[model samples]
Target chain A: MAFQLVLPDSKSVSQAPSPLAYAVDRTFFYAAAAGALAIILLVIYILWEIGGQALPAIGRSGASVLVNTQWDVQNSSFGILPQIWGTLYSSLMALLIGGFIGVSIAIFLTQDFLPHSLATVFRTLIEMLAAIPSVVFGLWGIFVVIPFVRPAADWLHDAAGFIPFFSTSLSGPGMLPAVIVLSIMILPTVAAISQDAIGLVPYKIKEAAYGLGATRWEAILKVILPTASGGISSALVLGFGRALGETMALAMLIGNANQISLSLFSPATTLAALLASNFPEAGAIERQALMYAALVLLAITLVVNVAGTLILLWTSRKMAKA
Target chain B: MTNASVLEKPTATAGAAIDCNIDKIYYGKFLAVRDSNIAIEKGKITGFIGPSGCGKSTVLRSLNRMNDLIKGFKLEGNVHFHGQEIYDKGVDPVVVRRHIGMVFQQPNPFSMSIFDNVAFGLKLNRFKGDVEERVQHALTRAALWDEVKDKLKASGLSLSGGQQQRLCIARAVATQPSVLLMDEPCSALDPIATRRVEELMLELKNDYTIALVTHNMQQARRVADITAFFSVDISQGGRTGHLVEVGPTDQIFDAPQEKLTKQYIGGEFS
Candidate 1:
């Protein structure tokens, strides 16, 4: 026989699965659904526990807890406005520095600028930064980062005294060191994810760019960056989350001062740092206030996550339309 | 082999747009193709027709130095574009590509708006003229202006497959390159789309020299003025591809001198 084109019977094929396979398939589907439901339930349960514990503080102080800046343990007046400002300010600063460095590193590694072996080595080293424990990072920040940064902070304060960011003289652990440490802490997270995003851009798209007489830099800046923007932004958001939740480094480096000031050299405290520093030595009412502060931090993080997701959706839609 | 009897000698004719004289093309010491000579004449469509694994695409890619992107792809030969040695040490490939644009086997438009896709080359070259006018001119030349005129702001990928391929053609033509290389431009398209692209090629011959690598013999006969045939050789225990013949399309299809060409056209083997 020369050849024959045999057509499968669609009716038989659709119904031909073994009974065991059907049972296994259904079982897997139900198992995955249950796992997803469990995750959602766990989140709700945690929120419930935190909210219930924070209720005592919320009832005792009302809205005064948010706007109050003085935290006198003896008088039991707990105001976390300064800590909230420090938390937002520090995380945003970390995001700006870390996001730029991470995206640059990702582009450098994935765009064939480095030799393959060298890129691999650099990538591995960057990833290993994440494996170092947070406490170790804190210790490193206290010794190496603070010492190295003190002179620069002092010079900035002297030279640019009129600017509020550099008005205060550097005495010891302060916002500058804390921001620097937080930035380094989140760099690996941002860089690794960004590398994956940039790497996933199709080779064909890059070729199209080069075919149009684009230099390597031109191709990367124009074609590859825009194509990977969505993924890169997601990576930044995750890095932001990592920076916001970091406690050990911030508690060790930030001066933990109760007063609010714009100077980077001035001591400051974040919500995570406040919780970590005050919970152990707190009396009963102070514990409730710390719990309430934790709840505020949780709300802020949730809002950031939601905003990131919305930004991603809006960008994709804009890209499609444009 | 006896087939060398019909092979054309390397000639640098005045009308040639791109001239290639090759001793060997190797991917990391493994000989992929050898002993090839082909010239793409100016203002005419030259087609490279060959079976799979015959290195037609490899030779086509070498003309524009697009093979430089591939790791270990080495061409031990000379490829001249309009009397300039494109592979010379000091000559930048980016500058060479500016004058010779290409359309890939797949429709590879950038994930950008249609207008931006066409304007990409113009922007890179820093064209001082109106970009909007140039984009419209290219789309009109590719026969895609009417359908996409109102939606130039839409993403290039939002179009149908045939439209996307045409959009890519417009993108390549927007920079006004002298030579256009199309590697299997119609292989991914339907017959109707293929016919439209063929018509576009016929219209583009007035201004640009085109080099095409195609698997379809009918397509070669339809649009190509001259055709180069490449075939694989396994007699030496390695399947190294080499050029077999280069002549007018009618002669290649109807009065081929080589027995291999006759056999291939007679449907003896793919």
Candidate 2:
């Protein structure tokens, strides 16, 4: 196709560009550019400082720092294998439990399972769960949650004792309670975002499904949920981030045991838990070890957030095309 | 298995398939529409032509209990579909909707693969046999089989506007509904896509009782066998829709009994 310069067929237009307008435009552009640069500068500064502080530990431990279990103070050796496993296992466990609960709450609120006024009240209560400080949750986990959950842990140990994950004897403050507390703390983050995602579906789409003879459950499962999958995945990512970086609550209740074990009943120390509990009493090498663990947390969060954003972007572009 | 010949079998035979006597419709005490009485004939296309907010779409939606979805929407009326009172105390809207599928004002193919969108209803209802065959038949009937047969796995939204509408039509027809309600099915398309959708509606009427709500008088004239004219009545609950006339398409267009109907069709008023 040949391109044609189609011009407006009528009136005279102003001929000259104003110098004042150009000045104002340039000033505004530079102001916005400066704001963006500040954020980049701040992130770089934090990463550089943390990396420099952690360099001593990183050089001494080599690649084995991530996988080696022992954290000997006298031997001057430090590794985070148990902490890494603890962080991964606890966060994954939290996701499995919290993700289900959050999605369920979101679905219930969005769908017609409850009356309008009732759903609103329930939604508010669930959102309120997020507003309470993490320290408060930590206290609750120590006193009430740990005691209340011991029986369930004992029951799991008895029922599924053949499995390595369930072989350990029950304890009040360990991986299981830590997982429970993390799941609770992250519930609102997951539910709130997932609810928003579910709400984004248009009424016309639901009407189309209903017109196709789908039951409410069928329509929800086959259409609405799939349509909101991107948002839900983003919610899970946020939940995972919250669970992974959680320090105060895990440090308070996790018993901070620094050894890897297959059993869920065994006490464990997550990266955040170890850093939070040991940072205040750290010597030169100990401080570097804590900073090393913090760097890993930072890297993981950055990766997770980027992946989550890409997922959201992909789904939105697909939605726009549709 | 042949597409055109299979859809050639006429479905509706005689009088009314859907009989409506809607006294009023309300959204939380705010009256939306009121007083509609019409007999939608079987095996033919019945066109509902009126201005905006004339309750043409409302009446069509009521036929299959689609109003049940709205939070505060309630209607005082009886709508009987194929001799069953659909508004009865013990009626399941799911079953009612299965028998009378609808096409929307906008093309709304589910955000899924073309083949999957067509197969959704069958899967939901747990079709016992040959899902792929049924999907193919539906697509073929909608006259989209030739264009999209090779791209069954492609997203339904990937198609052009006209093809998307046809895919939606295929989706609606997949479950073998006896009656099809369309609310301005061509309003969102270009002239070419509009013409294609209009043609598809005419072909589908042979196998389904079609109720269409349209603002386009030319479309009504071209496709409708029977026509219902509605206009806003100010006296009964303030600007509520009332059915003005219903008759054979030719008579309504050429020799309309109601002056309002004449004015509407003659372009005297909206």
DockQ each: 0.44, 0.72
Expressed between 0 and 1, the share of native interface contacts present in candidate 1 is 0.74
Report residue B108 deviation for candidate 1 (angstroms).
1.7
Residue pairs whose backbone atoms clash in candidate 2: B12-B43
**RMSD per model, one decimal:** 6.3, 5.6
Poorest lDDT segment (10 consecutive residues) of candidate 2 chain A? A1-10
Residue B95, model 2: lDDT of 76
**Over 4 Å off, model 1:** A1-33, A307-322, B1-13
In terms of lDDT, the poorest run of 10 residues in model 2 chain B is B1-10
Would you list the clashing residue pairs of candidate 1?
A: none
Tens-place lDDT per residue, model 2, B69-106, is 88788989888665557777656777778788899988
